[model samples]
Target: MITLNSISKYYETEAGVVSALVNINLSIGESEFISIMGQSGSGKSTLMNIIGCVDRPSKGQYLIDNIDVGTLSDSNRSRLRGKLFGFVFQSYNLLPRLSAIEQVELPLLYQQIDNRKERAIQALISMGLSDRIHHTPNQLSGGEQQRVAIARSLVVNPKIILADEPTGALDTKTGLEVMRIFNELVQKQGISVIIITHESNIAEQTNRIIRISDGKIIEDTDKIVKVKA
Candidate 1:
């Protein structure tokens, strides 16, 4: 339910203007699991930030369900972002002092949602962290901590999840487990999950793969081409 049209993001550094994303055109539909694969400086994360409304493109249009994002005021944009998107990162981004349940509750707390505790607990339990709800980040394993992060993202009931290297910190087995959870979200919850990853194996888990290089999309596995015999 998202569309990007000729999107380009640039930064004015001392060296001159550097483009993080160039001519990005993409459309993501409902309940789709997709992966954007790229190397360092490939603009995958920039694309993610733009898609999640954390940043706006320097040029081009971004529309969500036919609403032009550029036309919105800051407050309205923030509201739309909260309503439509949840984010996960490789760092886990958990507070050192907050328990798992508390971490999951933070988003709902920001939104002033009712019954925050019950919702947070259910989110964590859905991520298979029922027994570790009281543990802090330092007390949990890497996979458990990541699951907590995922649970935090879920409490918002977002239509889309933008995960930037979500499995980067975990072991291979744990990474696969995390991927399985994402797949389930698409199959069962009908959430659109867009993950930015460098690993081909991880991208392979998704239904479609978009490969980017030097800030431009080079390959999109979802695109259909018909060749005449």
Candidate 2:
């Protein structure tokens, strides 16, 4: 339910203008899982930022569920982002002092939501962290902490999740478990998940893969061409 049409993002540098993304076009569908893969400086993160509404494209059109992002004001952009997108990062960006439940509740709390604790607990439970709700970041394993990050993202009940190298810090087994949770979020919760990763195995698990190079999408493949319903 998101489309990027003829988009370009550039930054002015002392050396000159540096283009981060160029002539990009993409449509992310509802209930679909897509992976954005590329080596460093390949524009994957730029694309993610644009999609996440954390930053606007330097040029080109972005429509999220048919709303033109280019036309939104700064306040509107942040508001729309909260309404539409949830974000998870590789760093497990949890507040050091907030318990897992508290971390999860933060999103809803910022939104001034009611009964947020109950919703936060349920979200953590969905991420398999019900037993660790009261634990702080220092108390959880890397994977558990990442799950807490995902729980926080889910607390707001956004339509999409943008995860960047979600498993980078975890051991293989734990990474797989984290990936499984992401897959479950897709299959069960029906969230549109867009993950940016360099790992091939992780990328393969997604429904579709979009590969980028030199600031442009070089490959977009639907695994199995189609999955049997």
Candidate 3:
């Protein structure tokens, strides 16, 4: 459902040009569960941003369902992102003031979808947050806040869920709970999940693991043996 070809990203700083990603070529099939693993500065998040349409690549091609993302205008890219992708972050990224239902309703509001309140409620219910719909982030626990974030992402019914260190803030048990939700999305709902994680145990739970280092793919356990730098 997604493809990256010779993808390279760089940034110019006071020191000099620094590369964030180098020739990243990858393909993710529909409803696939995949993890991008790397240490700090490994470009996994950079790659996720590009895939999520939050950032544009400096070079190479990105195609989603055969459409070249590089050719999209800023408005078009935003539209495509709303239509095709849902994002979850380690920090939850919820509004401190908005209630759980309100937070989930925001995306549908952006899309001008009708019955926003009902849809958001259903999403929260699906995440087992029905009783907490009126609660704000401050009133919820870490695990509950992450579930709220997941509900917010799901309210849009996006084809691909792009999560960055989704389980980072929670304990191991809570992290597993979140992973179970993701697994349900892939297995039952047919939604693609791509997660960026530093935890090996978390990566192992996914069907494929792609390891990156120094801005390049060093190993792809799904397709081949460990690749040398």
* lDDT (tens digit, per residue) of candidate 2 on 1-229: 8889999999999999999999999887878888999999999999999999999999899998899999999988988888788999999899999999999988787778899889999999988898999999999999899989998998888889999999888899998998888888788878989999999999988989999998998887852355532
lDDT of 1 by residue, 108-141 (tens): 8878799999999999999999999999999999
- Off-target runs (Cα >4 Å) in candidate 2 are 222-229
TM-score on alpha carbons, each prediction = 0.96, 0.95, 0.97
Which rank order by TM-score, best down to worst?
3, 1, 2
- What's the TM for model 3? 0.97
Better of 2 and 3 by TM-score: 3
The per-model lDDT (C-alpha) reads 0.93, 0.90, 0.94
lDDT of 3 by residue, 8-115 (tens): 999999999999999999998888899999998889999999999999999999999999999999999999998889999999999999999999999898889999
Judged by whole-model lDDT over C-alpha atoms, candidate 2 comes out at 0.90
Q: Please list all clashing residue pairs in model 2, or write none if there are none.
A: none
Pick the lDDT winner: 3
RMSD of each: 1.7, 2.3, 2.5
Q: What lDDT would candidate 3 get against the real structure?
A: 0.94
1 versus 2: better lDDT goes to:
1
